[model samples]
Each structure stands twice: as structure tokens, then as C-alpha cells.
Target chain A: MKRLVILAVLIVFCSSMAYGDAYRVSMRWSAKPGYLRLVLESGEEIIKTARVYHSYSLVKVEFQSEFSFDYENTPDAVDISHKGSSLFININGLKDVKVFRLADPSRLVIDAEIEKTANAKTVPEEPVKPYGLSDVVMVIDPGHGGYSMGLVGSDYKEKDIVLSIARSLRYTAGQAGAKVFLTRSTDKYVSIDERINSTYKKKPDVFISLHMSSSPDFVVYYAKMDTSIRSKDRYMLKYSQLGHLGDSVKLSRVMAEVLREKFKRKVRIISMPLPLLSSIGSAAITIELPDGKYFDYNASNRYALVNTILKGIGKYER
Target chain B: MKDNRYLTALISILFILVLAGGYIYLIRMHPPEIAMENKTEPSSQPVTKPGSEEHISIKLFFPEGHKLVMEEREIPRVFSQKKILREVIREFLKGPAGTGPFIMPEGVILLSVYIGSDGVAYIDLSEDLRRNFHGDAIDEYLLLKGIYESTISNIKINDVKILIDDKEVDTIGGHFYANRPLKQLVTQEIKFD
Candidate 1:
């Protein structure tokens, strides 16, 4: 009888704890007169007809609506307040939330504890100067798009993998306060000439080309010859790193080091003659992520690689 | 008493098997084995056989119908006359014939060369060589480095210096710092678009 009673109490406690877990809320506000749009992660739509206000040097809108509760929280659920453009929110028991504002298709982001629910009253003030490293623009080039399949891995395509990683780097770098540009957002063929020309036009502080490796049939055969023999495919593909922009060895070295550290992968900085590297006076580094038969495209590995790149960009931020 | 002994013997066998399995598992999981398998391979092939066919003389050949006349000059041997540098250069230019699609560049015209006693070979280029070559700064640097380093390495020259019309230039086209001569290492191949 005593054990049965204790078991019932334990089950009730576990159920309540699970019910109290927080959930994400996102909303998009668009097509307003002055205010364009507001999007949240929760997928909730909040349309406001309030007048725009400028306080603390930020643009904000005020609206009166009943806040819908999506997740359970403690009695002192942290209240997020926004008066102008700036937003202020505190997690109940968490710190170090990453925030970002993407500009191309403007979106404000806030990552916090999801369980807490509170009404925000004041948006924080935008900083007088941007709070990131200034005068640094990173041009991320995802190698091989469209017709170019660029190193096919068993689990994923190299082009797709590189683009995803590049996009993540761009986001993290932007958060770190660096202007970032992608050579091509979608799958499209960018010629060697165009790739170099694009860098010249952007005049980016640094140019990073992301790529992956493929196991050629020769490599598979060679492996049979000596299981210990390293694949020559890596060396054969390394010829692609050569660019025709005027020589900037220092830039190449720095970029190589940063990429190697971030990806925790083996990289060869080939000093080869190519038109793209020659024409672009900017420091350019080509990053080749491990591909087919080399590395698995798992989420944890991807996260670690992305985080390493973010850390590398952070070093150059200031 | 017989049942007790049988049970004890069975237990002893099971204990030994478990101990052996754990030992093998620990050995497999050791960190050194992981690193030994994951080491990166060396980038460039190591140079061997100083004067072997592996170190072939690269010649620059003109198109079949082109009207550029050639004059034969005595081959200079910085170290020994037996290893003729001029004969190698002349043979390289006259041997291969192809324009695009992986052949050497047309504008890479080698003029006069001065071999130093210190195994440093100084090759002079025509004034039209720089104008004829079309590539970005890094590409040009790499191309020039490749041409110079490959020639020097095959010829057993230690260092290479580039000069245009017998005058020292800061850079080939104001891109690479060619003010000082470069030492020969691995020759980087240029991929032309």
C-alpha cells in the first residue's frame, strides 16, 4: 500500500513537470504603413494598427491585445518589453541568449527560455553605433552550384553541405558585426571568372570559398592497393584552390588557419597558379570540408564545424 | 558436493571471458589508435633522383604555322657543361605543340638566362611576355613561380630570379614581390580557364 501510494505521487509530479516545459512562439507582422513586418518563432501572427513611436533612438509600435499563453511558467515569468525598435527580454533562470537582426529580408531574432510567458512593455534602445566588428566584410563563396555537382558524398551533396555551412557562418558573422555576402544563394553556376569578378565588385575584406571532397573511382582502387595509402583525390581536387587575384599569401595563410581550426579538418593551402586568385587583390582562402568516405554529415558534427567557423569569425570581428 | 563444484567451475569460466572482453574493448578505445588512422597525408610528392626522367625538361613550343624563328645558342652549364641548360630549354620549346586545353601558355617566352655559381639561375623575359600573359595577380604570381620553380628544380638550380629586358622589375606586373629571387621548392601548377 505504501509503495503504491509513493508511485502514484511520483507519476503525478513527472506529468506536471512535462506540462510545464516551454514552447516557442513566432509571428510575422507585415504590410503596415510605416512598420513593415514582425515575425516570431512561434508562428503566431500579430497584426498591429498602432502608431510608430521613436524613443531612445529606435522605431517601435505599441498595440493593445490580450497575450495568448502558449507555455507554462513560474509566477515571475520574465516580461519582455519593447517601446521602439529595441526589445528587452530576460530569461527567468537563463543567460547568454543569442540575438540577431537580418537585414536582407528584415527579421529580428531573440532566443530565450521557451517555458516563460510574459508581456513585454519596453523595447531596448538601439546602440548608437553597431555593436560588432566594423570595417570587415566577409564574402562567402559556396563552390560548385547548378550544373556543377561538386563532390558527391554518400549522404549529402557537397554543394548543399557547403552552402548550409556558409549560410550559418554568414549569420554568425553578421551577429558578430561583420558584413557578409554570398557569391550565390541558390544553386547556380558561377564561372571561375565570375567568382573572381564578384569578389572584386564586393571588395570584401576576406573571401572564403567552401567546398567538399569526393572519392573518385581511382581512389577506391588505390585504397585496395594499400589500405594505408592516402587518397590522391584530395591532392587532385586541391588544384581548384588556385585563384587569379593578385597574390596575398598572408590572407591565404590566415584564412587557412582559421578554417582548419574551425572545421577541425585537414586542409591543404595549395600555392597554385589560377586566374581567380590572381585578379582578386583581396585575401582569399578556400575551405574544403571532408566529404564522401571521409566524414559523415551528422547534425552534431555540422554544429561543431559551424561553431568553430563562428569562433574564427569572432576572432576577426574586433 | 559435485553440484557445488560444477557451479563454481562455470562461474570461473564466465569471469575469465568477461575479463578478456573488457581488456580488448579498452585496447580498441585507446586514443593513440584513433590518431594513427586519422593523420593527414603530405601535400606534395617528395623529390627524388636529381637528374632522372622524372625531372623532364619543359619546352615551350610555338604553333605549327607561326612565323617565329629560333636561333640556336650554346647551352650553359652553371655546375657542369655536361648538363646543358640551353639544349634543355630549346628542346622544351620545340617538343610540345598545343594552344588551349592544358598546354603551356604562349606568352611564356624565355629569352636569355644567366646561371650563377651559387646554383641560382636568372632568366630574362621579353617585354611582350608580361603584356601577353593574362591572369589575375595571384594567378600570374603562381604561374611565374611554377614556370621558374619547375625549370630550376628539373635543372638542379637552387634559386631563380626573373628579369625583363635585362632590367630588374619590382614585380612581374606589380603584384608579386619579385624584387628578391625565389628559392625552388614544389612547383605549383596553374589551371587556366
Candidate 2:
């Protein structure tokens, strides 16, 4: 009897072990003034790969294991598709997907902003007065803060140099009647998510990220997907979803031309799939400055670089 | 009294035997348990010989203008695919012989390279690649593209996945997402519409 009891207990324990690591998926959405926020809750770390079918306002979450979702009392009516170990959570009027991972309940939360519909019955809005470049809103992000020193030169830190340049650009751009915002105004560590969230929230007209390069020459980049040689048809370009990739490329070209003409430095414009540039709603470009012996920001040439960027912005709008 | 003495001696012998058995069990399990713990660390080595060296002609990619260009390079090649990838990357990091306007960030070190059966090559680099970025989006793009293109063109591998210090990185220089493996031959020539 004792042996039989032990065997029964062993069988139960072994069976329980089979389902030990099983996980489930839950979703919730809340309506805000301008957009809708959707949160997805899961037991394990949720996979980050997702595809948005804009026509259907659908988002497909790709995962490796079996999972289930909680559909009770959802704010928006969504179509749920569970096929071959993937979930397609489709909601009406989904515009953007911003994901956040919470540690408390181990939830993978997605904030999907809804697209606003045009109200034909409302009164026609009045035409506003014209302002030259005044309507242009710009966000100048100086990369790296606190512990993320970026690149450390022999004498100067990349964070300090870029921040100084950003400060100067902000003042210059503001004086030109444009509203400017900075990701970090001081020396503090901010995650990439916070920076992207802030930029997307602001929805600026143009976004320029500043960085100091350890390389000898300056570089400008927009957003493009890197191709894989081995991957089949799975690799796709992400810039199409960026929404501002066109503006980004155009702005990048103008900036490159102006910087090359003014500074006579080697400047190359390339496309990359950058989170800050591609994920944000605004037209974004990242400019890298040379931190070599000849490229000093404190010298008189600092203002020249700023003037060059300002000219590039003017050229972009024109 | 004699019966009590015999019982005591038998009990002591049995206790000693139990103690010896427990000690032997622990001794047998200790080494393997420690080995299991060590196995949890990052797989630092690849399934290839590191010291085998030969000569081969490989196609190298470099950043030229706004595009990546290919050049043929004849160098002392290593036998293993990982070593070959490492040597080629090191050569690219050393910069081309002529006035090529593109180079990776200074101080970036290649940690390890592991090619899987799925044709994806995991290239582990030091954190300096991320920490030492000086904010040039174009340079970052070119450097990453150079790595991707050079590896794929020279090696039989299909994709390049970058890891910083044996850990996955989200993005390098805030411009590109490094979380996924980059396919080879992906070009970013500026197209105006």
C-alpha cells in the first residue's frame, strides 16, 4: 500500500511538471481623449515581434508557446485569431503600437493610438494666419546621458559635447520662431523607450537626434531595414510603417548637402532602422558630428554647424 | 549487560555505514552539479577549430558614399567558418587600405562568433560598440552594414545577429534595432520620390 501510494504521487507530480511552464495572454484597452491604450498581459516574457495590418486595424503577436487570452469586458471590439501558435488581436481604428513590459505581473502592454475620424456635421474650422517656419516644431535629442557616455574622447565626453550642441541648437532654433523640445535637458539616464514615447507624444514636425562620433567624419542617417542573406521572404522593410521616412530622407539629404557645403567635412547620408527615428510619428533624422582633433564644438565653427542645420531645416520646409 | 553491549556495537556500526553511504552519494553528485552550474554561462566557444590558418580570397564590403561597395581581399584565412568571419571582421575593423570614408567606432572588439545550423551567425561584440557610439547615424549604419555585408558575402552564412557582450541589444546608436538578425545584401541607397 505504501509503495502504491508513492507511485501514485510520482505520477501526479510528473503530470503536473508537464504543464508547469504553460502561459496565458490577456488583453485590455482603455479610451483616452485622443487615442486608445491596449495592454496585453502574459505570464512569461512576451515576444516582441508584431505585424500591423492597417487595413484591418489588426495586430498579430507572434509567440512560440500555447497561450490563451482574456476577452471579457474589452473596451473595443476586436477580432481574435489563434492559429499555429500565434495570436492576431484585431481592433477597430488602431493607428500605432507602442509596447511596454511591466515586471509586476509580467505583462506585455501595448498602447495603440486610434485614428481620429473626420466629423462632416461639425462647422468648418477657420483658416489660421501664416507663420514662416513658426508652425514647424522640432525636437533636438542629444544622445547618451549619465552612465551612457556615448563615446569618450581623450578630453571630452560624447554626452557633454552633444548636449552642449543641442542646447545651442535649441536656442538658435527657438530664436528663429520654432518651438523646440529636448529629450534630456540635463545629465540624467533615460531609457530608449522614454525617449521614443516622449517624441511620439509630442508629434513634432521634425525630429533631429544629435550624437558625437568616434569616427573622423560626420554621418547622417534616416530609417531603413537591414537585409539578411539567409532569411527567406521574412525580411521586410520597416521604413514604410515609419510614416515619416520620406520626410526623414529628404531632411537628411538637405542636412547632408548643407553640412558638406558649409563645413567642407566628409558627410555621408545612410538609411537605418533606428527606433527613435522609425518608431516616432514625426519626421526624424540623426546627425553624427566628428569628435576628432579638428572638430571642436567650443570653437567658432560650432555656430557654423548650428547655422548649417538651421539652414537645412529651412531648406526642408521650402 | 553483555546483550546491551552487543546491541550498542551493532547500532554504532550501522550508523557508521549510513554516514559513509551519505558521504559517498554527496561526493558522487558534487562534481556533476558544479559542472551543470558552469554550463549555464554563455556559450563562449563555437564548434570550430581556432588555430587552423590558410590563405583564401574573400569578398569584402566597405561603406562608400551612401552605399556599400564590395572589394576582393586576399588574406591568410582560417579553416573554421567562425574564425574566417572573425578574421574578415577584424580586417574590416582595421579599415581598408585606401581612403575609404567608412570605419566602425574605435575600440569596438569582437567577442565571439557562433554559426548555427539555421544559417544564422551570432556575432558577439564587446559593449564598446554600443557605449562608444558618438551619435552618427550614417556611420553607425555603414558600420553595421559593412559587418553584415562582409560576413555574408565571404561566408556561407545567411544572416548576422549582433550581441553585445554575449547579451542581446535592442539597438545600436538609437537608429537601428539590433534585436533581430540583419539579412545580408540589404542596401539603403537614397531614393527620392
The numbered model that scores best in DockQ is 2
lDDT of 2 by residue, B132-152 (tens): 665455556676888888887
Worst 10 residues of 1 chain A by lDDT: A217-226
Question: How high is the CA lDDT of each candidate model?
Answer: 0.46, 0.66
- The residue-by-residue lDDT of candidate 2 on A1-318, one tens digit each, is 999999999999987665544456677767653366667766554534333233324566776566655667544224466776577665433446776666766666667665332001111122321224576898889887655666655555666566656766676677668888899765555667678778766778888988875566677877664343235533323222245667888889888899989888888776655656656665788888887455755434666666778788888988
Per-residue lDDT, model 1, residue A307, is 59
* Residue-level error in angstroms, candidate 2, position A239: 4.1
* lDDT, candidate 1, A84-103, per-residue tens: 33333322222124344544
Candidates in order, TM-scores: namely 0.34, 0.51
Question: Using TM-score as the measure, which candidate wins?
Answer: 2
Candidate 1 global lDDT: 0.46
Kindly report the root-mean-square deviation of model 2 from the true structure over all alpha carbons: 20.9
